[model samples]
Target: MKHVRLLILLSLAGPAAGAEGGPLVLTDLAGAYAPGSLPAGGGWLALECGPAGCALRSTRLQLSRKTVLHLDEFRVPLEIPRVKGSPLALLHGLALSPGPVTRWHGAGKDVDRVADQLRRRGRWTVPGDARQLALSWVRLPEQGGFRYHLGDGTTRQFLFATAFEGHYGGDTTPRVRWAGDLDGDGRADLLLSLPDDNCGFDDRLYLSSLAGPGQLVGLAARFAGRYPACGC
Candidate 1:
């Protein structure tokens, strides 16, 4: 393990080719195997088939390391292999201004690092600023995306959508939501609204564990928010 860490540090010299083709100082860490929950929520994570583990990293080089763990019965053989590699951000980090990305080296290094990078890349607004940020994967108006709105100087705008090119009306948007303490833990929980038939979709409520500023620990669907007629 020590040797692997050394190699990772050594590879931090020049920009390495990212999974998306961008040049970055990639790390050299192997997948971590264990039984854990999905960052998106719901049942235990099944990683025995793919890479031993998965990680979420922002464009600015911030990373959320994933660890697997088991729940329920111990009879289930959950073995995660190291093969899928690292996950790349679908969209660029939102920043406040233009400058070199900030490299956060604190306890929440990964999350902080990503936030700092977004701020540096002019991809984000003030942490608490009531600003609307749109993040997308692939080309705009052609893919899915997320929205972050600094709400009423008190709440933050949280929305996730499958369609990237359009916005939602009212709060029916599949993604407009918030992260609160659903379980009474200090950490925040995810609460998203599902779409309705008008949007050509069924509405529902989704929940997830917020690991950090923008990292989801695990995800699950709680209730049905929309019910449409069949064969519409």
Candidate 2:
């Protein structure tokens, strides 16, 4: 079967409310995608909008069509927003990797000590056939997001962190879990809980954003159920 990568723009019912009467709608805009071409197994869908009004109405980016025979990687030349005043060029396609694991402490030790200790306890193993590991930390009564440290236990490292969107901060320790290949080369994704929320629906999944061994995307989507028992 020949796989064709399609771009679908879907809009919820009702007229898209915008400054104007209706929002600019963009539907089934097919880009230069090789039909029957398989996309990167662990890749992501990149949404691009031109410099103008835009809205999606029941459209889907059918990347599955690009995967015909054997599974492969999907690389789409998506034109995304450059800097405030930079020339626009085709940015590399979005790639997907395993997620990150999170960990919180109860002893209330300092963050520096916790990170260092986790680094010391970092485990290295080649699962399946991939290489790379990331270490992230979540400190309570302070920040909500984790600091992502990329690279092996050796040297030369890259580090970054994703803080909460707004002032809503953390007051308690967040129990973290690792999601990735257990015996392979995939990274571990994470599922976290935010008990501080009074409403009880603070659980969320941090999806992989960047296409690398270690790089955590912001809150993918909220998880089901309200906040469960604090500990995990």
Candidate 3:
């Protein structure tokens, strides 16, 4: 029970919770893994498959420096492979040629609209061939006010953020820290910072290849950077 509880704490640890700062951790919003690296001199790899963190020696893949672990499991690879970890942001499936990055702090009267900002920039591309990724912040008129639709696009629009609540509504502000082809699908994949007054620091990864029947992209993973109020 103590081990299980310790694992849970590790998953949710943040600056406020006495967590020692290291590289930024990217996790499957729905998968199992841990945020730890092997000893400094290129040692064996271990994967904390569960909260218990019962790591089995898996096949090792050569890496240049410290990295986040990726393993097939004990039976498959003799060791787990690690990718260079980042304290700011990290995501899998991202191909070269990083996408254009944009930021919006958010507000009521300021109105330095994110939509207008991207439109003014004109072009945000990914990879050498450079395919244009559609980006928009569509506002639809509603009964009381306008509803917001924000996302990227290819043939169809891929929404990562939306707002129906009025000006006073408590909605998390969506900030796009980076955008690119993480899935290599020639469509835009986004890494967004969605922070709430109560929810703490939350980063999300969206991939075009994982989209369901109607979505242009689907949430593939997440990294909870910090949490001050404890998520219930």
Candidate 4:
């Protein structure tokens, strides 16, 4: 068997524990955290967004005057910092308000009708041989160069490329970092990471409440980063 490390941030088949029992919780490290509020053990999922890339880490929270993450290999940050004043995070397991995160993969073949409807003859495919689709990224001409949709491949009205419209250049290669309800609104929100630069991805958050008319999601937040490679 090929040894598979979790090279992607927040692996699709992630651990399921406290995810299903409640609405999604996005913790703000800059704010006050109550006692016993966060998950114990290595149960927290954090996405590190830098100008060059983004990395997903599952860690245990250590509260103090500062916040420290307990990771393997004695890894840690020199100082506690916040992204854009409030770094919202997926605190625990993968469950959202309505259901679970989509375990999307690039293993399934594209439906010809869906591709033709979207009109992007790119590498269109479903998520791991399933009938339902999780994401759609179509190629564009002479501009930001891409349009993204999140759905089961029927309606492309939910365009979400605005998150990267003015933020990236030269083919903003987007990938869904995690996909599910983020704000308890019953519509699927998204955490996306893409290597528009040569190194890593710039992360973006889209929520259902922020969606425009006839849309399912809209840009709520952004985390810009870059790294040495195009992966977690």
lDDT top scorer: 4
Candidate 1 on 51-161: residue-level lDDT in tens? 232222222222344322223211221222232333211112111122222211112243344444533442433221123222222223434343433222343444343
| lDDT string, candidate 2, 1-232, tens digits | 1234222111101111112221111111232222222222222222222344211112122343322222223332221111211111111122232232122211123333433454355422212223444444443346355444434455323343444432355433333322332112244433344334332323334434423443333344332221111111
Q: Rank by lDDT, descending? A: 4, 3, 2, 1
Residue-level error in angstroms, candidate 3, position 204: 1.0
Q: Which segments of model 2 are wrong by more than 4 Å?
A: 1-134, 138-171, 182-185, 207-219, 223-232
Badly placed stretches (over 4 Å) of model 1 are: 1-161, 165-178, 196-215, 222-226, 229-232
C-alpha displacement of 51 in model 4, angstroms? 31
| Best by the TM-score measure | 3
- TM-score on alpha carbons, each prediction: 0.25, 0.26, 0.39, 0.38
* lDDT, model 4, position 159: 49
Q: List the residue pairs that clash in candidate 3.
A: 24-86, 24-87, 58-78, 58-79, 59-77, 59-78, 59-79, 60-79, 67-83, 93-182
Per-residue CA lDDT of candidate 4, range 69-181, in tens? 32322212222223332223544444223222333221113222433434345333443323354566665666545666666555455444532343434444454444544
132 in model 4: Cα distance from truth in Å?
5.7
Model 3 collision count: 10
lDDT of 3 by residue, 1-232 (tens): 6666554555443433113332222321222222222122222222222223222232232323222322311111111224332112433322323332322222222223443354355223332223444444444467332222323344454454444442345543455554544444666656565544543455566666777875666766554544321332
Task: List where candidate 3 sits over 4 angstroms from the true fold.
Answer: 1-87, 91-132, 138-173, 224-226, 229-232
Q: What is the lDDT of residue 65 in candidate 2?
A: 32
lDDT of 4 at 231: 25
